[model samples]
Target: MVASIKSAGKLSESSIRSQDDLEKVVEQEQPKKKWRWRVDTSDAPKEIFNRTLYLSILVFGVLGSARGYDEGNISGTLAQVSFKKTFGLSDPHKSKDEVANLKSNIAAMVQLGSIGGSLLAMYTVDRLGRIRALQQVCIIWIIAAIIQITSKNVGQLYAGRLIEGFAIGQTTTIGPLYTAEVAPPQIRGMCGCIFAGAVYFGIMMGYFANYGTALHMLNTSQVQWIAPTSIKIVLAGLIFIGSFLLCVESPRWLVKVGKVELAAQNLSKIRHLPPDHPYIVGEVADINELIAIEQEAISGSGVFDKIREILTVKSVRYRFFAVATMSQLLGQWSGANAVTIYSPELMGFAGYKGVERLKMTAVLGVVKFISAYASAFFIIDFLGRRKALYTGITLQMISILFFAIFVTVVPNATEDVPLPLTASEDRAAKAALASLYLSGVGWTMGFNSIQYLLGSEIFPLRIRSFAQSAIMVLHFANQYGNSKALPKMLLSMHKFGAFYFFVGIMAISLFWAWFFVPEVAGRSLESMEDIFSLPWYMIGRKGAELCPDHSEVSKIHVNSSGHGNAYDGKLDYDEKTSVHHDEGNSLMVKDSNEKDLEKEVKK
Candidate 1:
């Protein structure tokens, strides 16, 4: 029978009696020429880059700024003369060791709270939708910020920081996950990178906030620290408002909850396509088919069943350990977080004092901010994920090794008090500072950007929230440990010993990524199973070669009656053929005569 397919308001006639016929018609309709501008988007429709998608990503992206502001501001705020005097750090009766312990506790308080926040998100994200969970996060953040701003003693300040950590932990889990769900496959890498970029952007703002307050405000007044602490309130308030006005619920989450019609409408709005358009129909069908397959594979709906499935299933377990868990653990231990949380102190070790240290910290924030977006714009999609990791990690290793050597050759007598240096030692100190900045550039380009992107996109929808929360918990735990231990490590392990330890960790991380981290730059979330289905050892090296694109494996058949309904044909892991009706508007077609035709051609 002759079929009429209506797409983008144009109708075309073709004879699509069999699956093979439908495949040919779909292939012919695709653009023949490759469109390249930094990265290829030939597989994506022009409409996918609409204004609505960009605006939604931007709103969600700013959620990361809360994290950045806290990391950026706290280090400098703690360094303020008035802050130390008010917090009892200036007490002549306290020994240097007692002072260091107090500083560590104060600085690491938020990270301690973040661990609880991540655990809380594991339950809240799946129960409440992504948007609702983030809304609560903002409210909690505002309250915490107010407490910190009004603090009259050290105990009050610690309580405020601990409460604020809960909000920061939840944002880390939800922001990237939502962005990955809404973004088109072609630009998903760039969109995911924006969340990471927002982190650096927040850090930049926090550094400058402290710098402005310190430079202009009185040293003895509490306003010097209070003004900078209030930046979190402004950021949280803006995100809370934007959540309702600009953002929409994730379509994938909608489909998981059996709201198929609403999912289709939301997907159409984001893609800028009609409900019946082949692209939208095909995407919805893919989501439904994968969720069904996952449900059938495990056979239970309970949370324990999901956890058992994750542990028993080889592919899921690999994704959890190799992709999600390791990314956070290794990324945190790479020493970048320590550099960020203690930038002012690190500058002191490098021989800069007082306002000069704050100036350099501001400069460090700018460098990281620029490199992060630069990777999103130029490197990530172009070089692909694995290559970006290689380049960035290598630069990080080099920079840290040099800084270690410089410090070992010329150790600083005390981090709190700068000592005079010889002419040669002075040059070495300046070079060490430059190395620290270079490490920031490498860090943003590689682990910082990709960790969020990889962990968010690599998990199945059934357990995505659970897995993400688990990863974030480890993220904050490792961060807390690093923040608490850095001062002690510098003192006991010696100036160079701590850096040498990071150098060792970075070396191991580089090798681990080469063998385990697969290239997932251009693939859709639904198609990730194909990449992970290969032999665990072969995924990093042969995933692209063994697994074909989703379009090739899953075919969409337009009905000949011109009712605008499409039948989705998909191949599951066991070689079973599943047919999904688009929007439940079409009748199922029996393909008993061509059973083997639906099986994917194995390489």
Candidate 2:
């Protein structure tokens, strides 16, 4: 199969000009007695998995670790009496209002930086290239880390947090995007999971460092602030440098931007594929198909025209909506940032004070990271995207319900508001905090990792980065909303009110997933042409026969002639056939040219 695909390389000049004509002629022949699926790296040498793919995926994980360090370390560092004093947050017990306002400002402001970074990422990701984008974000993280380390007051800390947020947004957006484009399709989901797991690892590390740093403060004065956590700044800076030197560029991006030779070169370097390796050939073919699609779209010019082009593609438009909404909503619903940035105090409200609450936060981060790993390994193959998310979202909604029940109904049942500190009451407070941690566990496993992975997968190359960035920005916006709103809502309307709101949102999102989001498990980007043809009703409900059988191929060509020379196995504007397919059967295949033309116009 690989040999046949390789032999069918490079359309000739005459053949190229009359692709439509050639397709028509090719269609008349009863399809050969062969499978109709495209080739991915499934049968490539085990060496394909040797060092390069694993190392690259792992390096992507390191990116997550660096991110995790920053995410986790802040909570611990913020707990130190001296560290809080440096930011004028000392005596938080007496100045709770002032400290709370400042903390809120920090949380809200980081998202503002994320807004800028997210917008920048959308514009520069494709322009600067994925590796370069990641490198730049790394630089930002290092700078922000340094700024944070030297901060003198709440204002400087705010600046540093915002800067860090920007870097985080870009890293989150590009890291997974790069992983998806570069990793072997067989392990793509796993690679994505590695990145997510790395993040959790970082979060756990941050918590560990923070706990160690504040644990009895036994270190010398010069190293007091420089104990376990002081190394975090160095670790972050090192990750930035390492990724810049080590991470490979996405060959697909290189191909899309007309750097075919460079794309081929990068593909070889990253895969460690010898010249003429089957993987390289399959990759090149895949690249060529995407390039052709983009070229067709590029016939339009001018910035506005290009922007108009993006808005026109049905896939792009829908992806943009779904990704953006998911980015925002998932972060919020997962209750991660809310818990990480504010829950220390919230837990304090329930009486788990000092390093205890901080440790719990770290535990939650670990749960998130580990679960992401689980999702990465099993999501693509064992459970399709829909089932994983269905399970995940359902779990999160249930957890949030129980949490709200604890907050509103259970607390009332105890009749324990303002209760005296009996051992029984202390036990109850501890139980409540434990429940919140459990809620964090459920939300992180499903919503956090799946949303990032799915958002990156759903769009085509022509505008994937742009679409992803927009979605990520919206994710930050959602995070910001949750962070800001939850605290205020908790004060104003009580905890259950906030949880109930998330419950409603997650319920709607679950419905959206059941009905709208398609399952892309175990399928390559090219295979997505099948997904394009699927009706909304069939999405996530059943799998489509993406690769036609030899018999179906014969039928396709037999009924396909003179139906407009455009059908290259993609759907088109002719809605009568594509939209109204019979039940238990998928939508019709379409012409490559017509689909590209239509996608370009739609964008």
Candidate 3:
């Protein structure tokens, strides 16, 4: 293109020569090697991160406290003696195994509903906008909470849990994603960790709420269950009101939809800078530049066209599967829900029951919340996400195995009779309890938050909502399977045997993480597309290579749908632009993903 420039003699020959010289200067200044671009916001002047950003992420994180409350409250409710009598859950006519089955369904039904919620989020988050999707889910949560409070029978309770679980699934999918997209790259992990901390806080709230209900309404028929169920409604109400007033739409989403000017305005608001500020300009350029590359990947094609490519392309499928599905599997298969959901039953294996069991369960929630809090604040970004997760998984495996052995070898007499445990048995039970607490702590430190964090990080802008929804679908499905199967697994195969199953799964997960969990920490969200577009083998080693800088990036055109199917080698800067140039068949870039593949195949 430079060689082809024609002059109309408006300027002197000296001016024309200077133009060519400027291009040469840029070439001479270019770097010799390319690697991941790191954004270090920690060192940025204090003003770079403002109160508004913190407020936004904190409000979003508060949504997690609602989730934690719901999850932990149930463990306490299940241990309530009157609550069981109220439901006939432990009737003498029902066999011990039948009761276990009923309990499993009650625990697992919410996960079934969550599966549907996750699928709905995939479409709603993309089509309706993130804030609107969250608003709708909060309403659903409130209605579900009402049902649980007024539930007349076990069926109604089941229905309530299922519907509420659906809402939980969507919140888990969208909340972290919204926070991740809105925050600057330097503080992105810290913001996301807040959501994880909130969930643990919710867990703590739920535990106390349930304990308080059981304490005050010791003899009340409906208040025992009704009071604890009502806590979710309060949390949901706050979310509903805040989702609109407090939250802003994702700036990246605005750019994807062609509202570039508005995206800049919103970005300015997020950064506490004017639209023309250098930092704001740099971020908008990054988003637009990434959109440009992603557009080339599916250029001139309909939405379904790219979907087909994502499905049929072997490398794309593997990459997508590793993130959206396999990462979820690794977390769920660790037997976390099994150990957590039925804490009372787990303690029965250690001869702790009644108030003692509930206390132990609450203690576990406190442990998990504390560990998650510390890890989210001080550990995740410091250790780096991948290292923290892998190390934590190893700890969880060891702790859970010790828990299993403690139960199997030093059997709890509570398994045979409801009698209070002997002194020696109580000591052993407490030791086993400590091991289980360590397991929760380990899981909380790593896999607990990383699934949400990694899901937010892995996908590019165009398909992120879709990819994360897919990840959450797999997430809910695993939760459902574990919740449903855990009680039966404990009853039939024995409780310790279930731990062995998780131990094997964790062992396998270590291998999976080593091969597929690439190091993406400190990288900008815009650069994620480069990583996901890589061929299969290069993943988990070097991540997506950095593209050209802003000035060069602006030269690449964004197709109508933000994805392009053609590459003319113009963006390479090394190539001389030509209108009629041919690469072998001149059919290059005809395929959807052929844009990124050009460099690979040419090699």
Best by lDDT: 1
Rank by lDDT, highest first: 1, 3, 2
In candidate 2, residue 321 scores what lDDT? 59
List the pairs of residues colliding in candidate 3: 68-202, 68-203, 69-202, 295-562, 295-563, 295-564, 296-564, 299-563, 299-564, 299-565
- Models, CA RMSD each: 6.4, 11.2, 10.1
lDDT of 3 at 21: 62
Q: State the displacement of the C-alpha of residue 14, model 3, in Å, after optimal TM-score superposition.
A: 22
- A best-first ranking of the candidates according to their TM-score comes to 1, 3, 2
* Best by the TM-score measure: 1
Better of 1 and 2 by TM-score: 1
Error of 1 at 527 (Å): 1.0
Measured against the true structure, the TM-scores of the candidates, in listed sequence, are 0.88, 0.77, 0.81
Q: lDDT: which is higher, 1 or 3?
A: 1
- Runs of candidate 3 with Cα error greater than 4 angstroms are 1-42, 299-307, 413-425, 533-535, 544-603
lDDT by residue (47-142, candidate 3, tens digit) is: 548877777777777877756777787777776766687767858999977887887787777778888888888777777777888888889999
| CA RMSD (A), model 2 | 11.2
